[model samples]
Target: MSDIAKEIENAKRIIAEQKKRIKDAQKEAAKAESKLRDRQNYILGGALVKLAETDERAVRTIETLLKLVDRPSDRKAFEVFSRLPALSLPPQPAPDTGHE
Candidate 1:
């Protein structure tokens, strides 16, 4: 083969190898993303299940306490607790000034 033709053939071979490598890398990336998504979903589902179970237990405990307490005290306790707002993650406050 002429020198120019040999060079052209070598370039084509390099391009083909590069394309194959790129395709393989893309497949591996897709597989890793799918695995990561599955793990995230499983963790989120488990957290939701745990939160529901805890909420149910809290409600049952509160009901039991109301049953055990007399009406007047139970009403008073309920009023006190009701005064508090629903619990939530509040924004973190800035550090306090040391100046008194």
Candidate 2:
């Protein structure tokens, strides 16, 4: 083959390799972002659970929200919250005016 033919083949190979590399990088980035999102959800859920354990409003709100969980598995996962006794939430504390 001529030199020009060989150079064209080499350039095409490089382009193909670069495309694969870009695709792999994008997949890796997407996976990392998914993991981060899951971690954030896990942390937020834990905080909510902790708050619900002590606060009447939080418990009631969480129980109310659980009604929206239509999936059997999700409903089953929420069984732990079902055991909290219903309680009247205390009036919310007034916000500080910062005037002092």
Candidate 3:
């Protein structure tokens, strides 16, 4: 083969490799983003659970905020949760006084 033809083939191969690398990088980036979203959801769920246990009003505020999401699924989830029974914290025992 001619030197020019060999050079062109090499350039093509390089371009193909770069394209493959770019695709792989994009997939990795998507996976990373998905994992980040999952982690954020876990953290949000934990926070909401704690807030619900501590204060029903705060949980209601979060439900109201969820309605602001443009996604229908978010609103639907909030509605479903609204129908569920409210979380009640366990009653705390009264502190004993030194008199007893």
Candidate 4:
């Protein structure tokens, strides 16, 4: 009877340890998911900003090209090509990548 009781206590200890591990794992997974979501949001916002910058730059370049062209046909074509969707918001300055 004593040996049986000892075995039951040992089993309970093992179960308790496993339960703790499972809880820890669940918490870790939630933390990881939160971090992943933050990273994804950061990347998405950056990409949208980059695309806006590119569009703005293209429009400016096209305008300059149109001015430089002497022929009417070339200027018209460039004007048509340069037209793009209006930006929803003003473009933000790109962060400098050169600094450490």
Candidate achieving the largest TM-score: 2
**Candidate 2 lDDT tens digits, 19-93:** 999999999999999999999998997787789888877776776776567665565555454445343223344
Ranking by lDDT: 2, 3, 4, 1
When sorted by TM-score, best at the front, the candidate numbers are: 2, 3, 1, 4
> How would you encode candidate 4's per-residue C-alpha lDDT over 1-100 as one tens digit per residue?
6999999999999999999999999999999999999999979755655555667765565445445676655444444332243322223345589978
lDDT of 3 by residue, 25-83 (tens): 99999999999999999899778767776787877876666546655444444444533
lDDT value, candidate 2, whole model = 0.74
Better of 1 and 3 by lDDT: 3
Error of 4 at 58 (Å): 14
TM-score for each model: 0.53, 0.73, 0.61, 0.51
lDDT tens readout by residue for model 1, 1-100: 9999999999999999999999999999999999999999979745644554558665454456445555554355454443222321233344579877
Candidate 2 wrongly placed segments (more than 4 Å) = 80-100
Specify the highest-lDDT model's number. Answer: 2
What's the alpha carbon RMSD for model 4?
Answer: 15.4
Q: Give the higher-TM-score candidate: 1 or 2.
A: 2
Pairs in clash, predicted candidate 1: none
Q: How does candidate 1 fare on TM-score?
A: 0.53
